[model samples]
Target: MNLHLLLADDDIDDCDFFKEAIDEIGQLTLSILNDGVELMNFLLAEPANRPNLIFLDLNMPKKSGMECMEEIKSINKLKDIPIIIYSTSLDRTVVNHLYEMGAHHYIQKPGEFSNIKKVVEKAISLFTSTNSQLRSKEQFIIYP
Candidate 1:
């Protein structure tokens, strides 16, 4: 399958690294959004071209990823699309909240390029292997 992925993050270097990893991973198309506001605009404007998955960063300018996720979940048109929290924070409290709020999965951003690939691959694998949109809380967080 040709997976269409959307990633929303503010850091230019992280976006570059993620794009590189996706290229290496292959079998997928990716869209990179610079901030939360841009991500919302892209999603809202392109209902016909919805992504298979969204990898969202928590700390972003304009609006936070948390805000985006909340908004995405509230809308009937976008709620069912799987959201993977792709963030640098390992704050357990926040992770728990995201899981409760219907985020499909959580990934604590790894420091190394190889680990980024690993975590991204793991998230995709989960999507392919399961029919359910949400995973068990025990399995919510992907460890790098």
Candidate 2:
């Protein structure tokens, strides 16, 4: 089966980059949303169409990814869907809190397009191979 993934980020360029990478990877379907509210609504509105995994950006207008994470975990129907925190900042404090909040994986957005493809490919591979199991804290931050 093709893997269905969701990427929620405000940056249009990032969304396009992610799409291109995903397209190159093949055998995967991705849906991109600009903000947290739209992401939540998309998930809630289509229970059956929800993506298998989520790539969430921490910084967003209207509602932050952190808040969205909290809400997702709180909702029974949405709680089990794996979330990978895809953000630019690698702040240790926030990373620790993300782990505490139950993010399945963490990815620091790469500067290079090649790195983005590499990082995303690895993230998807790990998620599929491990059956969406949460990794150890040391292994949480995925780099290209």
Candidate 3:
């Protein structure tokens, strides 16, 4: 099955890297939003356009990832879509808070190109699994 993914981030380099990784992964469709406002707009624009999974960056201008997460969770139509926090920050408190707020997974953006590909592949596999199992906090963070 082809998985549809959306990534919201402000960093141009990170966005480019993610696109490159996804290109290497193959059989996936990706749409990107540069910041939280654009992310929210895309998500709220049409229910039919919503991606199967979302990769969100925590730090953004106009709106933060945390703020977007809260809004997404509150909206019934968008609530069930899986969200993966893709950020450079590894703060334990923030990670814990995000878990509680209903993010499906968290990934500390890997520096290496190969590592980025690995993590993205793993996240896609995990999200597409049929089991629908709830992962522990330790398991939530995907490492390259």
Candidate 4:
């Protein structure tokens, strides 16, 4: 089964860049959500379309990453799926708060395209390995 990823960020270019990076490194499908509400709705309402992982961005207009992370973790059904916070800022306080709130990982957005490419590759590697470990232990594919 192919890996699937969901990106929850308001920036269309970032989403596009991420998708391109994913295509560069591995075989993965991607979906983009422009806001927290959209992200939550996609996960909650469309159970059939849930992705293996979600990449959330902080400081959005309406619903923020913190709020979305809280909501996602609180839900019994959605809590199992990993959520990573991807933001431009490197504020330690925000990172710690997100970690406390139950984000799987925190990745600071890169300014340079080369850096973004490297980061994206590493992100996919980590995410895939973690999920693979889980599935291997369970003797079943976790994300498809």
lDDT of 3 by residue, 80-117 (tens): 88899999999999999999999989999999999999
Cα-based lDDT for every prediction: 0.92, 0.93, 0.92, 0.75
lDDT of 1: 0.92
How well is each residue in 1-144 modelled by candidate 1, as lDDT tens digits?
999999999999999999999999999999999999999999989787789999999999999999999999999999998999999888989999999899999999899999999999999999988975657998899976
Best by lDDT: 2
Q: List the residue pairs that clash in candidate 4.
A: none
Error of 4 at 16 (Å): 2.0
| Candidate 4 CA-lDDT value | 0.75
Please provide, for model 2 over 1-144, each residue's C-alpha lDDT reduced to its tens digit, 9 standing for 90 to 100: 599999999999999999999999999989999999999999999888899999999999999999999999999999999999999999999999999998988999999999999999988888888867556777788989
The CA lDDT at 41 in model 2 is 97
The TM-scores of all predictions, comma-separated, are 0.97, 0.97, 0.96, 0.85
Per-residue error (Å), model 2, residue 125: 0.8
- In angstroms, the error of model 3 at 30 is 0.2
Candidate 1's displacement at residue 47, Å, is 1.7
